[model samples]
Target: MSRTYVKVIPTVALLLIAGFSVSAWLVYSTSLGTDYSKYTFPLWTIPEGSHMYTQLRVGDLNGDGLDDVVVTGDYSLEAVFQNRTGGFENRTQILPSGSWDGFVLEDLNGDGSLDICALNATHDGTYLVTLSNSGTGAFAVASQYLLGPIRHVFPYRSHGSDVPDVGVYLLGDHNHIVLLHNNGSGHLTPDVYLSLTARNILDVLAADLDGDNQDEIITVQDNGNLTVWSKSASSRQFSNVSRYLDTVQAKRSAWLVIADMNGDGIQDVGLASNIGASRGVLVFLSGDSINVEQPIIERYYDYTWLGALASDLDSDTDTDIVLCTQQTVLVMENSQSGQIGGEIKFTGFITPHSPSVIALAGHPSPALIVLAEHRGWYDLNLIDLVVFWREERGILP
Candidate 1:
């Protein structure tokens, strides 16, 4: 497969001055300082042939121990396997052109191979489609269950089960969470409601935030509040709910990422606020208990962050923050105290959405992959799978 490599081009830098003059009571401390233009970002774009791409999932699909990509779109389901040259092969269409939306990659059948659980929206209704992988990059339809319109499907292990279940945000009428439990037979059974009252569900993340042995389901709502649902020992279901980010500082929450931002053992929550006057990213330093009142706040005056991911960008054992805007990619180094230190800006991404991280087989650092749509030659519409193989200074081949 052919790939497009564009040389590093310097983009116009907009210096964000610290301290907001809007509110005097609000102590405006800037973690991301005024230094915007420092290093050139190294990246390459691969034309995966647009299908109105919606989501991308990474895993070892071909059993090569390399992270392969499975992409879902409005009219296509495709897989791009990583080759030995630290690149990808031509994308293979996993299913015929269809209305595919949110999907996840996991071992559904317990055959040790990763399977696909995808949501397909059709003219009739939305359906949960399960595709069984043959451990050789080949997939076939295992089963399909008619479901309501869903936003996304994620891997969740419910009730201490060995099999990984699938959870999704069931939208329309009343928004809530519904789980399609894997019956250990490679088939998903629906109608399991985790939270019937979850309103305006924007994103869902599964992690053990409170040091409990059970995994907690964290959901970000459109109202800029976070709800954490933990499994009840007596009920055997996720019934215990705790709400966070219900502060005046948080408004119109764009997205949330969970990781040990500091060297602290507990998992911290990083949130990106997209709207309101104080729009920026903040890190919640979690403790043995849920801390909802206070967060280590950081604000960018002019830039609007759409999405963010927490990862150790320099392999320094401390988690760094990577926020995506329409124009540039922002990297904030994490101090040991869960505060931002230095920042790097990578420009030249058009309409970038859902930034992800994947470590190739022979690469020393993980690569940042983003789904971007831009116009190609002859003014044709193109969706490019843009990959950044570098950090602040380190570059990958």
Candidate 2:
């Protein structure tokens, strides 16, 4: 890098004094092509430096037989894009402006219309807000209640409601889980806070691990071990006994993704690890938990693999993998027999942190949405989220 300075000013100094001069500078970067040719488009973008700490949630919120997307990265700039045929259109903004942490789309009200439940922020305290869907892409303020800061928000059914209850992970060093109960009218009420671990947990996945009808809470610690807590639907509290996979560093990496790679009905788990002086991924096979100490698949790339998503990237009908690296996206084919093929890396991303795999309405194939924060940390003044799609394999069946 070289330091150079050019001086040019006052050519129109008298014009500036006469209020008739202007000076401005602009820069732009050209987009690149991915490894595979697919249907890719930019749905929407916000002001630069907006933190997409939470991934965009895609589903049918309006009940119009199409998938819509809701993004809450820019606090007071929450926007919902309705799946208009094969393309997405800006339907409306969830919040005009403000500091909102995260949000979830669930039927907070039993009105058969899916509502927006968001974590609103304020100077005093963060709040839980319920915005009812008046129609497709239309949301009205249902209720807003104050509480502590929320890192992650998941929906669960408690208090005997037809809809699921709100499960939140508090933002703190301590590992505490709070369940906010609904007062039957779509309003969230304060409920019990349960302590799950001594230290902080990375992420929470709400799913039914066993074949049982009840839902279970799965949390992964930094060390890569997992703890499964059975939830009582009626009581709305964790069961006294919990299941644990106390394997010795089964997940040697910081990232973890759960999916059934072998076409099994049960959901298996994948824990990423950087062991043997290289990057690796361990599989905690769901049924009998196969190869506990050994990893079913392992691979290394040039940069850091921040996150991984389990999806059928190709039309093979088997679950493939999408790895979100610091600079590119890698697609690995799953042999469906515990083997992974070589990596097919895709470019056109700058400091990409994570990627979300979603099926848009009208589009037959699932698409990958990656939010990039320029080259390093998130800058509130620059923004870019690219979408990659395929036409052959429509979204998962």
Candidate 3:
């Protein structure tokens, strides 16, 4: 398949003018700066016929030892781009994995290769399909099961399991959380399922909080109440549900990402809500298992709508947070002492839907991939992470 290439024009300059002041109402102190005097960003083109490339997952899918990406977009469009010498190349088209709106890629079979798990939307009925990697850039449905309507799908290593298993959060009045354990083959067996008292549940996340070496699932109800569920060792079920965060009223459109934000080695939580005009993002730093005494911190910005991703953006050995408005992408750096500050801005546009940080095969740092839908283009731009050396600036254009 031929890809669509575009001329990349970068306007970011290296200057220390206090800050760019993209958001005039930010409440945090920021001196975060970027030196872009050395180079231009590299663009990885998508097929011209592709609809909005909605979801992306990166891995060595074809066993070529090169990084490849699996993407799904409008009209159930799906394909995989193999990393080649120039950019990405795909000789043939990849069929959709049952046109599942949500999916994940992981080594589900304990085999040493990546596999694809896909599912249709919640409104499209209930089915979870597994496509096993045949080690030849092709996939075949190894197994499938009727999972009902699920809003989220993720693979995780449960408390005592060596291999990662699948967990899904059911949608609608189902109010159930289901787990499927991988049986060493590319198949999933029904392990545990639990029903909640409430309905309209949306998203779920798993992380090892409290540093007990056991992970707990974090979720939000449609009513804006944040809660967490833990696996009871004695009962062998996901029980012991408790309220985690007393969040704002505008939460139905909100989302949360987990990381060790406080440098505590324990995973903390951050919530990005599209509801509030004044409150930017709510961060609950890692604290006690039951409650962190003073956890909530509002890293203020002026944007009415926001979405966020938390990763080590600056290569500071600690994960930082990235937030994007309709027109700009902001990076919040984290010091080794867990201090979150020095926010900087990048001169680009990326929607908050799915802002991805991808570590390319050859680069020393990760690249930020975001779709500039506002620019009225079908392609996306990559912000390459380059190290700033004083001597290299003179040689690089």
What's the lDDT for all of these models? 0.60, 0.53, 0.53
Q: What's the lDDT for residue 341 in model 2?
A: 50
lDDT of 1 by residue, 1-397 (tens): 1111122232543323224211111111111121321221212223355444356676789898776777766677888776664556757888766688778788988888989988888887788899999999899999998777887677877555767878887788747777777888688887467755757676786777766555677777766676778775345466655666554443565667776755678887666665564245454535345544655444543455656777655566766667665555565666656556554544433322312222111122344443333334332233445444432322223
lDDT of candidate 3 over 1-397, digit per residue (tens): 1112112232332322235222221111011122222222222333355433255555677777655556544334244443433234563345433444567778877767888887754354767888788776677778888877777887756756656788888777777888787877767988888677766665676777766656677777656666777775445577655575454454545666776765667777666665455344444545345354345354444553345666554444666666655545555666535456564544332223223332211112233232222112322342222222222112222
- What C-alpha lDDT does candidate 3 achieve relative to the native structure? 0.53
Residue 79 deviation, candidate 3, in Å?
Answer: 3.6
Write one digit per residue (lDDT tens) for candidate 2, span 264-302. 666666655443333444344453353244444443343
Best by lDDT: 1
As for lDDT, the candidate ahead, 1 or 2, is 1
Ranking by TM-score: 1, 3, 2
Runs in model 3 with CA error above 4 Å?
A: 1-53, 64-66, 82-86, 91-93, 97-99, 121-124, 232-234, 277-279, 304-306, 336-338, 350-397
Q: Which one is best on TM-score?
A: 1
Off by over 4 Å in 1: 1-53, 245-253, 276-279, 283-287, 348-368, 376-380, 390-397
- TM-score for each prediction? 0.76, 0.70, 0.72
Model 3 RMSD in Å is 9.7
